[model samples]
Target: VFVCKKFLKKDGRKVRKAAKNEIMILKLVSHPNILQLIDTFETRKEYFIVQELATGGDVFDWILDQGNYTERDASNVIRQVLEAVAYLHSLNIVHRNLKLENLMYYTENNHNKVVLRDFYLSRFENGPITEPCGTPEYLAPEVVARHRYGRPVDCWAVGVIMYILLSGNPPFYDETEEENTDLHNRIIFCRIVAGDFEFDSPYWDDISPAAKELVCRLMEVDQMLRITAQDALYHEWIAGNGASEKNLKDGVCAQFEKNFAKAKWRVCIHSCSVNVRLNEVGNNSSRGILEEKPDEDQGLNVLLARNTTQQRYGPLKLFPSSVPAHCHSACPRRDPSTLPHFLSLDYTQMFKVACSTPFLLLICTSL
Candidate 1:
């Protein structure tokens, strides 16, 4: 099956430029771990990009309270991403954005290969290209400092990914007296630019020292000293016995559920293409996609095929007094465009649907 991504020309120059960039980058690489572009067509009002469909969910989908998870499992995931980055670097192509949200499994199976997706912010690096564009949490030091940067920026992001994968918490976060998205982002930026992060006592205690060393090397503040993806692929944790066999499910799940519980359509799993996989698993319940309209522009899959990054996304607020908490996952009146305003909901019911109740996996994303 294939996923056809649509971009309304009216979305403006930023969207058009991103579409152009994504097409160019997909055409330039042929790797097992990267998304491949198949065909492209454009109309006066829009552009359509038909690419191979990855039926598996994003990185977090496989790790959240997933059974039998371990440090070694996280290592395997990182190694695949490093291999993809290593290939991109060899061509001098820098993927400005690299995070858990952008990484997907080729299928929902336990042994599915990890595939790196999303390349709209990618560019061919002739030198230290300077441009501040990326998810706030995953931004590299040079990007935040507004310094000219190159491929090492991607490596720093890899470190952040590794850190999140191993500990279930972001390396840099806001803990000040005041709190809000804007302020939280600002404080996090300060921490990122200063390379202020820690393995915190309890989180790092059971984690292997070699794993910690690799995280530090990948996330080094000095871009010049950051470990390259090609080099990182050979790290002890990734290539040898550095990763411990100890199961990290308990601690990792606790933090992941708490930290990311607020983000709704914000996690970049925007492609409706993932819905096809859900249907295959007989997930026809209220928490599933509810219906399937695979034709382009027909269902949730095609509507969110555009650049639905975190910047355009906000936390899932759930139902308000106006809307009932018992509503189905795919309410008929619920259009993708109007879903964001409907985010306010019953917090208790939402968690029950998400955690022990049924893992309320709302793959729904909004702009």
Candidate 2:
């Protein structure tokens, strides 16, 4: 079955514009690692776009099911993403949002290719883009600083993705951001603008040096020095034998669950209904949240992955909205230990688990 998305015209001028732009981008590109568009329809009040569906689920769920995961595996995943980004770069397009939530698997097999999704925020870079939009932790230094930027931002996001894939922790998070959010957001921005992040001891101990070097280059404070997606494809960590074979499943997964499972700052603060979706849970179906009510007649609206799994989805934001990076976090200069230890919030006001949805209905309205 194909997935159909309904974009309401009344959502406002910006949303309407974004929906049209997304449709154009989806129609312009086709790669084995990117979602494919099938058809489109426009009504007087809404636009309906249909696309191929993924039954496998997303990268997060795939990671949870793996008994053995290594730096090499992470490298392979990153390489595919870079290849896709390189292809897009050749076309002068930029996927502004490139977080873990956007990567999915193609099937339920033991081995599958990862695919990239959610291009509503992606844009064709005709010139320097000045808008600061995207997930906070993944925003490039130039974007955080409100400076002109373009495609390197995606490479920077790839660096953030690689960091989480290897360590299970966000490179730029401040444990204390939960208490004083606005102040912390200011602090996080300052740190990001300064290119202040670290490969802390225990986490980086087993990680390969070449991999670390690549992360640094991708997240270079100066966008001018940042590695392009095409160049990054040749990095030793991605091309050579720089990734370690040591199984990092326990440590990395524990951190992944710890970091992503927390109720996000906006989720906790916003007084809105969150459509929570669980990926690949016991069926060839995808799981996700949407603002719309569950209606059997509605059919499928969004497809997360092609992998079928009994394990459920990865961090539940694969079809997340374009969140402008105004999040809070602690200053990076403070000793990580000194920040108040953050407690994981069980899915309460913001999150709900899905039971059985053949396809994810992920429609979020930004507040």
Candidate 3:
């Protein structure tokens, strides 16, 4: 295996950091579909990442020899590819560069297996990333546009891969050099619309509906609505399960719900604060009572109150009236004994407080 390391210059800090991060992410990821990183080293000029060599070479070479891969071959390759992607995304990593050339085939015990290779264009999910990289044909709309993108870019590339694998052609084309660049630019900005491609061939007739659905969903211009890698893992075609079995397993569903609950809680708290501020603008406001404009000392007190309340009652929903009561009741004038008891009350008790005080029970829910 040959490794490239010309990305370590002082001006290449970003590239170096990205390489290091890719190595770190690769080390943490283990899957049957991923090519293993055997070893790594660094010279002053570059970093070397040694990966297992695929004796059968890249998918592009294989396709060239065969002219076009059969549907079964495409399905087999795509299944492995998606499995690798699913595993990477589970670890919050995105393989931003995905194409036939990046897929390698190796023989193990005389059995052929496909593995995903290349990580120079990969990224994590911690923050915004704006590096323009990846081959032109597989570049996502957002990636081509030089916009901050996350894991969804990987999904778009997956769609492109699927298109090439099944149809033996890319979804977009240009007759002129200028038009080719313009088409790439348009793809980057998500200006290309779906249903623009004609697929009247008999080959498309045998393609499964699930596979087509997944491709369309993954290639969606709207990043927010794009199928996440995790969700795609459970997709009907990829999973080989019917629509009814497409739902996540019970345990997985529970974990998903838990994460959603936490996110919803944060949103609820933020919205509550905004609503409180808006309500404070009107007369007969409870916002003032909630200590909306808290001083330093009051801020500390409010933190203590929230901590104590959470410890005792879990997450307490601060209704309009409940907010003021919770904030004011924690004041020095209130009895210390009552404060401890109130803090110990559960979310149900907090809900009761909101219900009893109609003013506090606005549009807010326990979210």
Q: Estimate each model's TM-score.
A: 0.72, 0.72, 0.56
Q: Which of the numbered candidates is closest to the native, going by highest lDDT?
A: 1
lDDT (tens digit, per residue) of candidate 1 on 264-344: 233222321211111221123233412342533221111121222222221111112121111111111123366452244
If both were scored by TM-score, which would come out higher, candidate 1 or candidate 2?
Answer: 2
All candidates' lDDT scores?
0.65, 0.64, 0.50
Worst 10 residues of 1 by lDDT: 324-333
Q: Could you give candidate 2's per-residue lDDT for residues 1-367 as a string of tens digits?
A: 3444656666556556767888899999999888898766666766655566554666766776789999999999999999999999999999997888777676656355888887777889999986656665687877655468999999999999999899988888766745343343445555676678899878888999999999999988888889999999988899999989999998888887666652111121121112322111112121121123343222211212212211112211222233311111100122224523212223221122111111122211111
Best by the TM-score measure = 2
Clashing residue pairs in candidate 3 are 5-46, 5-47, 141-188, 321-360
What is the per-residue lDDT of model 3 for residues 109-200, given as tens digits with 9 covering 90 to 100?
Answer: 32258888767556677887655445445656555444577888788878878766665555654324342332323332232323244443
Candidate 3 lDDT score at position 171: 64
RMSD of 1: 15.5
